[model samples]
Target: MTADRARGALAVLQDADGKFLCEVPCGYIVEPTASAYHIRRERARAQRRRRAMLRRRVALTVALLTVAALLAALMPWSGSGAADKPKDTTAGTLEEVHQPTAVLLPSSGTVAGYVPNAAEVEALAKLIYGEAGIVPSTTEQAAVVWCVLNRVDDPRFPDTVLEVIEAPYQFSGYDPEYPVKEEFAILAADVLTRYRAERDGEENVGRVLPAEYCFFTGDGRRNHFTTEWKSTDCFGWTLESQYTD
Candidate 1:
């Protein structure tokens, strides 16, 4: 019938089951309502807004989880540094940006290991002199030089000051067993001793060995080869000898 009749019939149908079937006709008419359309649109809009908010929440949660997982994976290999962003390597940790120690050793049997104090130098000098029968002198420090050199190569050598000096084949102190010059023998022993010390990663022994060439021929004379002959080869040092006895 009419919209008024349909609404009245619908209200009556709500109160009683199957009673309005007798009053209503079989033919139907759809009557649209502005209030109904407005309610439907509002419900749809509310649903859409709810769905959009849910999607945004899910996306934010996923992003946070991804960032947390990445941080967890990186933390093991990563050092002390910034957050999600990278930091400057120049502003590193204390261990990373550390300065090196500033102690030096010389072939003169002087603090020729990373020994920072004067006491260590004097003790090392005495040890070199006592074992190898060499006097630790300013001019004849080659034996100390040799000992320092060899010591750097191997730390397992005799740790005693004297033992380091007298270590076997450690220094070429034993030359042709002729009546040796007292002064020369002492100087040679000193050099051999120090050469051994320098080889074992001893920072003190660095740059202490003299750049000078000490050449000794079979003729018993201290020889000096020209720069042309000596410049290319440190093997020229083969002539340099350290006397053990």
Candidate 2:
């Protein structure tokens, strides 16, 4: 068979319309099978693959973001907080510590006769805060309280601690309105206890200041740096806890 004859040849077909038909037998009942259909299918497959890749990228991004959020929540931000003042450090339990106060100076000799009560302790503590400004473990504060107690025993001053504190012009810083400070409160209480013990005949209870040497003043110095009196300066002021009187 020649190539041109084969292309031009046609097969005969019979129809059911009661007539003979003559036509080609090649299948072409509907659309033609061409390159366009294959192109469209390839484009659709490419779109589906792109969509799947986009979904994977979105899921990975979401997981990474979730992990970052969790890490942020779990991390502790140290070295970022409020600034505060140094808190006071007292040596004992609160009951032993935060208890109440005592004071006075007199023209004549005096000594404490009575045990200090809570109210007396409170008054004396305020007086010490007013005069001494409440330093930590400073005997200058105790000296201030001792001066007041020495007057408590003095017949020249009032008989009681409150009376001695309230006496006129004795303690220049004495503020009946002074705010109660914890340091002075404990100091006053401790001083009162020691004074009471010394009077009760207890020896060496750490009552360093002698009862006779009781008087603290901003003008006076401990051990009398310029004079024969005993003095010191814990409060940046000359404190003559021991004086001629």
lDDT of 1: 0.37
Q: How many Å off is the CA of 177 in candidate 2?
A: 1.0
Stretches of candidate 1 off by over 4 Å are 1-177, 204-222, 225-245
RMSD of each: 23.8, 24.2
Tell me the spans in candidate 2 whose CA falls farther than 4 Å from its real position: 1-116, 134-137, 219-245
List, residue by residue over 1-245, the lDDT tens digit for candidate 1. 12325555342211122233233332343542345556777999999999999999999999999988786555321111122122213222334213332223434653344343332333343332332222223432343434343444444444444454344433233212212223433344444434445555354432323434222111111222221222434323343333232
CA lDDT of each prediction against the hidden true structure: 0.37, 0.52
Worst 10 residues of 1 by lDDT: 215-224
- Per-residue lDDT for 148-232 in model 2, tens only? 6766786656788888777654455565655555555655666777677677787665554555543443432221111112234
* Steric overlap count per candidate: 44, 13
User: What lDDT score is found at residue 74 in candidate 2?
Assistant: 59
